[model samples]
Target: MTISFSDLPIRDEFRGMTPYGAPQAPLPVALNVNENTHPIPDDVATDIVDSVSLAVRDLNRYPDREFSLLREAFAGYLGHGLSAENVWAANGSNEVLQHILQAFAGPDRTVMGFGPTYSMYPLLTQATGAQWFAGERGPDFSLTAASAVAQVEEVNPNVILLCAPNNPTGTPLPLDVIAAVYDATDGIVVVDEAYFEFAPHDAPSALTLLDGRPRLVVSRTMSKAFAFAGARVGYLAADPAFIDALRLVRLPYHLSSLTQVAALAALRHADTMLATVDNIVEQRDRISATLTALGYRPYESWTNFVLFGGVADPQATFLALYERGILIRDVGIPGHMRVSAGTEEETTAFLDALASLEF
Candidate 1:
């Protein structure tokens, strides 16, 4: 094997590291991954189990190759005027993101995203040897049109990403702010609405804007609000051009029969899941108020989790929660933890844990 092709200029970044499991599963309380904390209702559970059982029978056959039915159903759910041509999916939104980058980005170009946002964005860019730009966000974690406009002029990237109702802090981007960024950049702009179900008033999803700006793309997931994290189903809606870019990079028959069936079941129970989203919204605010009452400064969240400024060390608190059989992510470095909003009972358990802390 020529000693692993040492003479070639193969990528050096991944060569020394063994692949590790995603920091997504097997944790106590499992809140670190920001999953929906509710279990599926009996009827919805039956739908999934039954659908998957039927799908399993087709195991020897290839997947739909395009996952057409799943895409169509997803379009109908989000109310984004989504079409099959404007939709693409993968094992998860993470993989959908990778497909976009693989098709649109290259070693000679760049990708830009805001700071204190998703941890995976920068990592994903680096995987392709693309220059990753971290445009700074305001101290409050919202993007200003002026700031974003200025950064676009400087970064001159091929793609720009905005995680509306973003991860960690959950601050949603305003629509006018998104329009301003679109006006300033000729490159692709992705508005990640991973938490849209919890964000009714923050901003109308950029999905509807696809008519005005063909460069716009909106990504949504069943993982968060639909309680389908384990099913690995995520969808993206965009202008046909952007959607085609994703298609170019997606593997043939990538979405398994397993994921497609599970998502169909979730869609069938959309109203029931929306009810769960209502409960999650209530729990999130309740947790926020409780966090403030306990002297922690929690951000105005539009997602299911709360990001709080605590008096204790983040690593120490993470360990404490871990020892106590609960888990939350100590994200973007020390002193901050992104704790998911669970059921009222789970929220109470987290509140109790916080109350027991000395600082």
Candidate 2:
């Protein structure tokens, strides 16, 4: 006899909970998710193809479980006195985070993060049987060192998630706030820097704080800056001991040989891969400026997406844009929606569609 999912004894906590994801329909101007909307340059594509072909003949063997060479290449790119010993990687930043939670927090332990941040934090914590405490962010969806330290003191969680250029809001937290939180908590502190490359060149990374902070982990992704989302390579820089801890929880040979090849190939052409960043940043600023001029409130963004408020009806606006084949994200924020910085043409199309709307 066939049994439905609920019919079987699934975990009680996940009984009625749905999975997390953004809309992924094949729209003409798809920008719902915060993906780098640029295609790989022709030169980069050729190099990636050549590298993958070299790895195809070795499919019979398992990829290096530790991904040692990849780690070294990643370390070289980071350039903060980091070596392979200080770096670790996984399928994506999410998986890297999961491995972290699995190793450092589980069962009776607790994890905490500020609200209106990355939605995946709680879900990932739940998967590890750890309790989640979502602390509140400030009115503007920003958090201060005082507020963050206060929450860390109160909750004393085993893990804490801090997003830089935070998701949905696109605001970067001050480095002082991160330092303060680290000082206030003995728990593992994860600084998610998925959008770091989008931030201003002068913006500092949490990596600078890793000198004496063994519990602090700074996570980054190639998906955003490198435009290698399809390759799914995300990584972290932390103390060597912390990197070793993650090894205990991650599955063996998790990163495939082909993935390593593609990522390394892309890394060789880092300049080419990141050439469109300035262009994307320009579009992001333009979108923010235009939205503000139109009587909407666009929050200051250091990331590739802009989060704007003052929509008469977010759902209505979302639907209207969808009907026009211009997909953006509602992000569950009232009176607000987010649009990724697409190519010039795509951005122009979205702006034109918004310009014609009554609201």
Q: What TM-score against the true fold does each predicted structure earn?
A: 0.92, 0.98
Instruction: Give the Cα error of residue 327 in candidate 2, in Å.
Output: 0.6
In model 1, the Cα lDDT at residue 77 comes to 84
- Span of 10 residues, lowest total lDDT, candidate 1: 16-25
Off-target runs (Cα >4 Å) in candidate 1 are 1-10, 14-28
RMSD of each: 2.9, 1.1
lDDT of 2 by residue, 1-359 (tens): 99778777988877878899888888899887889999999989999999999999999999999898899999999999999999999999999999999999889999999989898999999999999999998878899999999889989999999999799899889999999999998889999999999999998888899999999999999988788888899999999999889989999899999999898899889889999999999999999999988888999898999999998898889889999999999988888999999999999999999988985
lDDT of 1 by residue, 106-168 (tens): 798799998888878877887877888999988878889999999998888898889988787
lDDT of each: 0.82, 0.92
Quick one: best TM-score, which candidate?
2
Distance from true location, Cα of 76 in model 2, Å: 0.5
RMSD of 1: 2.9
